[model samples]
Target: MLAVESRFTGASGLDAMGAAVADALVPQRLQTPDPHRFTASVTSVDLGSVQLVRASAPPMRSVRPVGSPARPDGAAFLLLGRGARGEIAGGGVSAPVDPDHLVLIPGDAAFEVTYPERVEVVFVALDAPGALRLGLAVSGPLRGLALPAAGRALLAPALDAVQAAAAAATPADVADLAEVVEGALGVAVRAAAEPVADPRAAVRAAALRLVDRHLRDPDLGPGWLAACLHLSPSTLHRAFRAGEETVAAMVRRRRVEAVARDLTGPAPGPGVSELAARYGFAGGSHLATAFRARYALSPAEYRARHGSAHHLRRS
Candidate 1:
């Protein structure tokens, strides 16, 4: 397998470039733009049993495969971002996608993508044999999946590395590029596989994950969650119930648990009131009430006991 990475800028003719690379790496032609300003740069192309291409486009344009093409001999996975929206039309089915989702398009299928704004996307092409070995499909119908929060956490760092490498990498660095691409794909696949365990469980898990992801957000709460997850307050409650839990209960429990964990550390954590506020507690008294009810200790007492236990263990 061989790899090629190319970058295009100021050139509105990206379809030609994509077509050329696709022909060499897989087998396809880039269709003409529908109606909009179009600019695309193919950052990296890795050609092996599988090929990977990282590309970005300027705002206001759409791109599509020429016709109802057969599934390519390879598979394509797209990691898209920056509020892009599009549709995949193939296999007698058409699917729409937005920034918050990832789309898997089969090489053999004919599809069109429309972007209202500048969009950045990573395109990974996997050969049939390679995908089979990896227990993946090289080509097929379009599948849209929401990236799990955990997946996003893992993807952020890997993407940073890819971007950095692109800035200063030689063509001979195929091995290094391949390694990074492989690692990123592995993480994405694992995340896709696990999903949320259960959609109901996902509410609590996602809420916890969100708190971890955005601990500094003072406005983080059920309302924020309802908007972010695209659920109404009532529906959100139902989802929590699906997990055999309540929204309020989960939030309080997580907040207190986080406080407890912090208290167990060597240094004193945040102030009780601050900590309470940080975790969405109404006031110091409210936090104290909950802490005592749950752990039979005030926040201060818990920290003192934890410190004493640590000292005893050290001795």
Candidate 2:
């Protein structure tokens, strides 16, 4: 877990925390009835596929949810901890969550969470797609779900262990935390949603995760992805067929997109040949050809147009 703690105070604190909140967690607008009295703080631990975030303030009003266009990418599950009364309204549903409750806040829906007084909440952040894999009822609002006594017995301690290990985690421990979380949450998600199971969606997400993590491995292929995901190659291909792209195609697209970002960024990033080899391309020409197909500009041309301004600034 990569721990990041940010705090703000005084007259301008809430505004500053808003920008920081947008970057670290979600892109949303925040307001407080009284700015001078509002102090906001958030601490996040990046645990790969999921993140753990603790957010607190005197009182707040927020708009634009994580899955909304204003701020999209991840979904949130909030477990209220202390000192607040709140209402969340989204996707034509309204629910009140007390300190003893938990709620799944869908990523794509525009919603508002209002707090009346000083309060703190723990959020387990999941990639919007992974939420689907876990069979979360994400099409709309899902609230007031708590673990059964037995389920809570299994979950609460696992999370507490993770939190205790968060501040002093080594790289290997952090890498393993995602697997630990996915396994534990997989059980919890199933216990909560008992009827619906999308094995294809789960397998598809696993393949995507493998591709993202092993992009630098030159021999990444369907076989490799299958092995890592504990599925046969045929099963892997079958699972991915439900999506728009085939397995190989998706891997290629992600690699090309990554190289394009590096080339088009402000800093004097790696050269084309280096970028190609680093991202599992055969060479610079291989990367240039694919980049052109995707962006309509060769790597060199794209770099010249987007990155030269930064070079000039540096000079």
Candidate 3:
């Protein structure tokens, strides 16, 4: 089980408040004062809840904490709103952040955050295993970078989910919120890996990952995929090309392969239509067109030819 708490109060000394929040947020802590008058608070938790510390500081002129030790236990993702400008200095590179941008910092690295004006910022801390499972660096120092378009699309929803979860008071709601936070972390890590300019490729990659994660969904068509990847119809098609495949073809191929793999076992699998729809085929007939083209046999025939041998081995 994971735990989370939130704190909000006026600042006596902004530096002290910042330091307190930083200590509560990460093991390695630092803070600085800016010229603006602001109201700030730290919210969420680190235990599978997509820990976030957010602050809205006063405008014009900012200060940043410098030269903190690296945190080796977890990774961090930072989101800066449009009213803020800042840079992170670490790992032999200085990464800058614009409004609505995100930066990911791997665990086991040291860095500093700076702001030039009163800005709203959010920092998410993810556990080591969660970070690695999401294809982010497991260990080593990391610098910050901007969240690309595809990333922004994916993260914005997740962020909202986490924020809502953090505010939930009921135990059951908190548990459900934890799940949402975990999902948000997954989305964040995947988004961090996306290329900046070519959001189409990112969308395709994200869609493929989603399909791989939820292969059992019967209605996982291009429309569903497009919504999940935050792309339009034409945009999703372009992304498929960027990923070196057509969307419809890719869905058909993935469905067929999933069914084939399922058949290559001892257990009686779902029927042809069931398996076909599970992988997003429009219908049995549509599945047949592609399945026969790829395997030179209808779904039932192919299953009959290959299923027995594989089932026998398993048995």
Best model number under lDDT: 2
Deviation in Å, model 3, residue 143 alpha carbon: 3.0
Model 2 per-residue lDDT tens digits across residues 1-315 = 367788888668887887876766666778888888777788877886678777888777787754545223234454544457777777777666554445676555667778877777766777644565566654345465555555456555566567668878976787577667666666765555544436676667656766876788988989987766556799889988987889988899989988877777766678778888899888888888988988898777777787643332111
Better of 2 and 3 by TM-score: 2
Model 3 residue-pair collision total: 1
lDDT tens digits by residue: candidate 3, 135-196? 45433445554566666666666665566555644555654665665676556545666333
Q: Name model 2 segments beyond 4 Å from true.
A: 65-67, 70-83, 128-133, 140-144, 151-157, 193-195, 201-233, 240-315
User: Which stretches of model 3 miss by more than 4 angstroms?
Assistant: 1-11, 27-39, 45-49, 59-82, 191-315
Tell me the tens digit of each residue's lDDT in model 1 across 1-315: 233445554333655665655554344444434323445666555434445556566653344455634433334455445346655555666655554555666555555565555666666666443343234443346666666776666765675566566556666676577567667766766676723134444445545555565544666667876665555778677877777557767667777888788667665356677777777778888988999988998887787787533321210
Candidates 1 and 3 compared: the better one by TM-score is 3
RMSD of 1: 19.3
> Least lDDT summed over 10 consecutive residues: which range in candidate 1?
306-315
RMSD of each: 19.3, 9.4, 13.5
Clashes of 1: 5
Q: What is the C-alpha local distance difference test score of each model?
A: 0.58, 0.69, 0.58
TM-score, per-candidate, Cα-based: 0.47, 0.59, 0.49
Give the Å shift of residue 86 in candidate 2. Answer: 1.8
Return whichever of 1 and 2 wins on TM-score. Answer: 2
